[model samples]
Target: MPVARPETSDARVIAHVDMDCFYVQVEQRKQPELRGLPTAVVQYNEWQGGALIAVSYEARSCGVKRSMRGEEATAACPEIQLVQVPVARGKADLNTYRSAGSEVVSILARSGRCERASIDEVYLDLTDAAESMLADAPPESLESIDEEALKSHILGMSREDGDDFKKSVRDWICRKGADRRDKLLGCGIIIVAELRKQVLKETEFSCSAGIAHNKMLAKLASGMNKPAQQTVVPYSAVQELLSSLPIKKMKQLGGKLGTSLQTDFGIDTVGDLLQFSETKLQEHYGVNTGTWLWNIARGISGEEVQGRLLPKSHGSGKTFPGPRALRSLSNVQHWLNQLCEELYERLSSDLEQNKRIASTLTLHASAFGSKDSDSHKKFPSKSCPLRYGVTKIQEDAFNLFQAALREYMGPFGTKPQGNKKETWRITGLSVSASKIVDIPSGTSSIMRYFQSQSTIPSCSTSGCLQEDVAVTPSASESCSEQKSVETQAAMPEEDISITDTLPDLDNSYGNMDMVPEKDVSCQSNDAKEFLTQSGSNRGTQTKTNGQRINNSKEKNKGMPSIVDIFKNYNATPQSQQETREDSTVSLTSKRANLSSSTSHSSEVNQEGEDRRETEWGYKVGEIDQAVFDELPYEIQREFRSFLRHNKRPNAGKSKGDGSASSSIAHYFPPLKK
Candidate 1:
């Protein structure tokens, strides 16, 4: 087992940059005339302008929300201009975003090691950049606090700006004698300030930045301000910022564990946790999580954001509301095809650019909570192996749905007990692919292994598998590799469901318990607070009070063995010609059943104008064509035959019960209790 390690303390300069209302800003920049108005970026304006995903700060104050329906947004602020998400492949496209992001990345990468966090966020390690600046010419303290102090600090700074000083300083720093740490640091600050300005000017994007010694603090501080602002988190500012903070406000804390903390120990404020011993906390939680909580209370976090230009998986989805409920499998199948098309196009792009191969395909469907939910077909993530292509995704996704439905048809599946076959309209559909890695075609196994080992990002916390990786360490003392052991040591033991994850503990919601907003019959509102609620009204935990039936097998297992098949199926996929032929036949038959069963309830036009053609697509390489071509023609034929035989299913009927906007983040607990 990998033993707990200490947090990194290495002195490094890291910066987190987030563009202000990026999509809105992107729209604003292109149109210019839309500047300063209460504008928002909507996803699908054609049909009620799919919900407003990103609203400007000005709009936010008007009760505008991310997933609020377009109609609701207009109701909130009558004058809000709803700009639609760029259309491609007969639906929303984000290529303009990718293009805009690349431009910003090129400029941000000008400093040291840079990591693009998301479509609108970036992290840069400025250690070398700062060192070089100091070597060539010292930094001038631009702000004047006092005449004497300012003059003293700027006594030897270079008069001019730009990266020139960086190169010049680098040349001299190597030869200069010891004790130049302070000197190097002073110059780095100057470089960062200038770099921030360049991004604003060059990219026409307003951004806020946090410069620290590590990734966590940088991320934390970056959100301090938005729309052209930056904050510097010196080691001195650590305690003041972290102390007295709400425990849930810390990143990774706003999940189930955070709720559990408040429930089990009444540890509300981060400072409150400080009152307890780390050992006691561990006893309450688990080893890893308990220790993690302790270190974070002390302003310590070691998670690193890796650098990557593309998403690990591409997904397209939407949530269903009233009047749009999918009542049949046909509706679900139709929507699934549209979604599959989007996923396939994205996969095509990845294959073209990175020559990478995706080994897994996942399906997420939601249904109103019921006995049907306990059925295998009723839950989301009924995923399977996906071939890379539009048709392939359609076929595979539908087959997986059928597979889930077949499981649903079993003995434990949904049964008519009270004539309760109320329409099972889907509220959401999301298709994604994973297991993407660069295809080092000609490299030997040993060589590839060594290359992978060598590729670890040079950071104390997180590491990446690629040459270009994000390794910026926060400036905070607690955000260090040396502190990793202490950080992990402070974690608490926990038991969480696999589906839940940590939520964003940001200004979006403060001290609020993320809860299920919709009133469902099974819920016990007696709980203190939920993510959707405010004040002391939230944060209470509920337990089953009634005696359990002897039927432990039924109550204990929430999901079926069919669901567990995901864990074992990957081990031995086939038994050669014997099962291969029969499996192929079964697969074809099943797919045929699914397609015919899922013929209606489709939405989202699959073909869009902006959808890139497969003929010329490549993601930094030629993986898509070569990888597929290299596979045995027989396998390809079988895959195609299977895809063709399995008809697409309706996407709407699979929609499940749930609110997408509820802030509750559920984290599976650590087993080291």
Candidate 2:
């Protein structure tokens, strides 16, 4: 449904550019011999000679149409040539066509704010450019205009008038004292004509364009003249042109909505809608849609062209219809691997060219059960934090599919009986990456800063944080200094040392909780044992013969203390004293508690269980405030943003005191006894 905007929106100049049989043109360009032939681009030649996705003009003239099988096309036009789309990883690859479209977009974007509507179409808001041209180089004032501009098909003007048609177009364009809107349209016409010429010269491709006051009319006019032609929708011709237009031909009205209009209101043409009042239409349809119908019926639309040149997301998928459906896990994994590999290549390219990263990986599958009753059940889609690398994406995507399969199968379908046929069949599979965002500038330096200060070992082979680095402050520290000491100790050293690349930051930050629930079920026995042992030894001292034993004098062995790391940096005496007092209190309290803890071993065990249950995964609040204050402004802002996103929910509900210790405690909740 469309929405109406203020009357002022009608003043802008808009244009729609559409490539002429884009896929066929791409194929023709690849093989010059196919330029004048009746050609069609097809895929999967094994099935009915593949299916025609694109048909060239010569083929269309010979009665060959899109969606017709290649065999049908050849039967219609005996000499028709079929070009199969390139195949990679056992699926059709369209990257060549996509690259050609990019070349066209690069030229079209120069004249205005361009929006790539699809791989083969774009909408440009040329209001600013048109206004400037009209003010400085009005078409009428020039002695002569480009010949391409003279070929424009002016709406409401008949070409049957013969020899004077081009002259008439020239006159209308250069007509003095024309309406302001009409003059703007004339400037737009010249601009688009030049852009089209540039595209042809540079890319060896031709496109059709339409110029008008708004996107709808421009889109409508662009298609009026085909194959390297341009059309103009004048303000004076809008009503007359739309009156005879079929309602079904309007944008967004070609589907069910158009059918409804004819079946419900007996409206077959745009002119038929002129009889109903807006309120009457609103009574049947909702207000927004009704008002949109009323306005469009009168040749009005306010949709603005967005200023985005790149797609918001990228996806790779394949379908296995009927007999081709996958019935076994290995079969599904094989196809999923191919799809994931394609998706990874696209993601890596986008990161390299655009300096952006996608945060989510989504897997969509369609399946049906062997039983007739289960055929109607839909397979639910699943998503998780996306990790970089082909291997990582493939593993995560497969895990996600397995998760969805379990839900789709339910308890009874978990394990099939021995030698029994599988009960479900997968018909479609797709993997997409989305939630893309640009990497912040200066992030490289910030990463380097953290890496320089790191003292612990790098990430383990499992990509988990090493538990041997003991940085937490003991309980003897005084309250005043506890916050600063704890803050410094809480920062995870693994976060800085996980990966040397910026894109991999998501791997650590996105799933800061150490392990995702889906992955936990699939961990090896060694990993599980490591987790269990680590959880028990977190805050306990060794004991022998019912007496506490000191292992070594080197308490902070793995990583140097935050205070020591920053000793060379500028610091106030007051802050240093506070840090020292906090460390002393924490250490003293731990020693006193160690001697009396045998009787409280059960309590200690219970406490450890509670810690395991409530752990928030990443220790993100461990940097000392004094240390943070010494960072560059950009780095400070980045750190603050990270904390805001990763902090646990309801974490600020702890008792509030205006001290740094309470603030640190707010993020890392204390365990209950």
Candidate 3:
């Protein structure tokens, strides 16, 4: 649930902009012949005629809808072009639309503070711009209003013929003596109109916008009109517009919360909600939500548009329903690898372009037992310290799935074979990289100080395979790499200086839990809160690295597995120091002076023996010095440990094993006792 903030002021100007059939527009832009034709963007055409994710206005006119399947759309509009969403690694890739949205954001951000609400939606705080325009060039004094501005659909205006409606809108905006607040809204509408035009001119895309005093009203008005139009919610029309508005149509209340109000309180509209007192609503919905309900009842919302242009996290996932379920561990691993590859590509782009790094790699899956009727368990989500490589991600993800699988299948693995059922069937799988933070620029000196530790040895440089592979095609495979190239192709040719200033990608808005003003179910609400609510679905421990150890007995029972490859890959020297101290205190002080070098006389440390210790078998001497220096101390230790050749009884033990590397060898710590 979203926490309610202080009461919102009615004087601010906020605008919400939504692209018209964004995916369709992008596809049309790519293939101009498809423009003005009935079209829809679908994914995975092999499955039930494919799922329609976006529908063009022309298709809508022919009775086609986004909810329809590809075949259903064709039946509705025979001429409809069912464009497939780009596919890579056997899953739908939305990066093209995402990049296009980013282009739009770069333009919209010019007018004021902009918040990217989703892939194709944004909320802009144009209050300052509106106020400036109102003071500098009032709409009433302008010699001629832009024709595009005249096309705005003012809320509460009577239904009139096309020409008359346009004239009324024009006259109202250019009225000589309108209220200051109304004048401000008029300026906002003009600005939004200009922004929309600019978007079309530069990107060949059409969009709709709503201008009002706050985010809620603006969002409501934005959708009132269709493709390539704008709407304004004047302060005077707030009550009239909201009074007749269904409670389910308001943001945040469109789900079960709205249903509850109608079924329990007999509240059917915004006006009905006004009948309840703040105290009464608080008593029913808790203080925060109750106050929030009271404010929205009056068409007020304090939610501010955050100024951000990047997504908080990167993820790639696909759902496999019913018969399409994955039944084997190899099959699950294959899909997981694909998802990780896609995620790693985005993470790399973010790091390279935005100077950010994700700290956590999480895996989520939905599964069911094959034979056991009672085994309808959910696959737990698992997360581990994020390393910057595709192979690392795949290895970690496989381990996480294994840990989750054990829990979902119980201690016995699966139902008895006599029962004549499969082990498990995975219905959905997704991997995401989160807890992203900016890489501190101009900290080279500080980083060098840490790397100067005398015990550490110099190393050669190595590159990640993920960086070398173009997993998620930037634009489309057919398009030039320049348009969608998220790599160095889009960046300056010169090397960036450590102290050089870059755009701030760190500033972010807290997770907001706003409801859509539509009759959507609670599940819809949950999906909207993907960034916040997603973590809760994963039943794995959320502790950071080195904190806990997974107790699964199956972890190291066989030959070195994928999990063993990157075991303790994220361990830091600090953790190793802590472990050494703990051992010293527990026993005699003899363990305290143990050399960091692996020159002992044990068989695992035999003279002239050459072996890799780190999970990826990356040796400290062979690793790239520049990349190694930039890595966190924990990762540095991981590589150093891998370079060491120790043939002890626990030589193959994973991280979190105290006897292995004198540091937590387990990449994923188990749940706390």
Q: Each model's RMSD to truth, in Å?
A: 22.8, 16.6, 17.5
Candidate 3 residue-wise lDDT, 285-337, digit = tens: 99989989988888878888898888898999998888989876657777887
Residue-level error in angstroms, candidate 1, position 39: 1.1
Model 3 lDDT-worst window of ten: 500-509
Over 549-602, each residue of candidate 1 has an lDDT whose tens digit, in order, gives 111111111111111222222333232212333332222133223223432212
Residue 263 lDDT (model 3): 96
Give residue 365's lDDT in candidate 3 (0 to 100). Answer: 92
Q: Specify the highest-lDDT model's number.
A: 2
Model 2 regions more than 4 Å off: 1-7, 415-420, 441-673
Q: Rank the candidates by lDDT, best first.
A: 2, 3, 1
Q: Number of clashes in every candidate structure?
A: 95, 10, 25
Q: Which parts of model 3 have CA positions greater than 4 angstroms off?
A: 159-164, 375-377, 414-422, 441-621, 624-673
For TM-score, candidate 1 versus 2, the one ahead is: 2
Question: Tens digit of lDDT per residue, candidate 2, span 1-673?
Answer: 6666644644889999999999999999999999999999999758789999999999999999998998899999999999999999999888899889989998999989999999999999999999999999899889998889989999977775655887888888889978999999999989999999999999989999999988889999989999899999999999998899999999978999889999999998987999999999888778988998998998888887999888888899999999999987667778988998888878766765665566567899998788643546689787765655464466556656655665676545534224335677899999998877654343322332342222111111111111221221111111112222223234433222212111111111111112222222222222211111111111112111111211112221232211222221223334433433344232213322332242333333333333333331112233333234323334455545544444445343322332322233134232111
On the 0 to 100 scale, the lDDT of residue 380 in model 2 is 78
Per-residue error for 439 in candidate 3, Å, reads 1.8
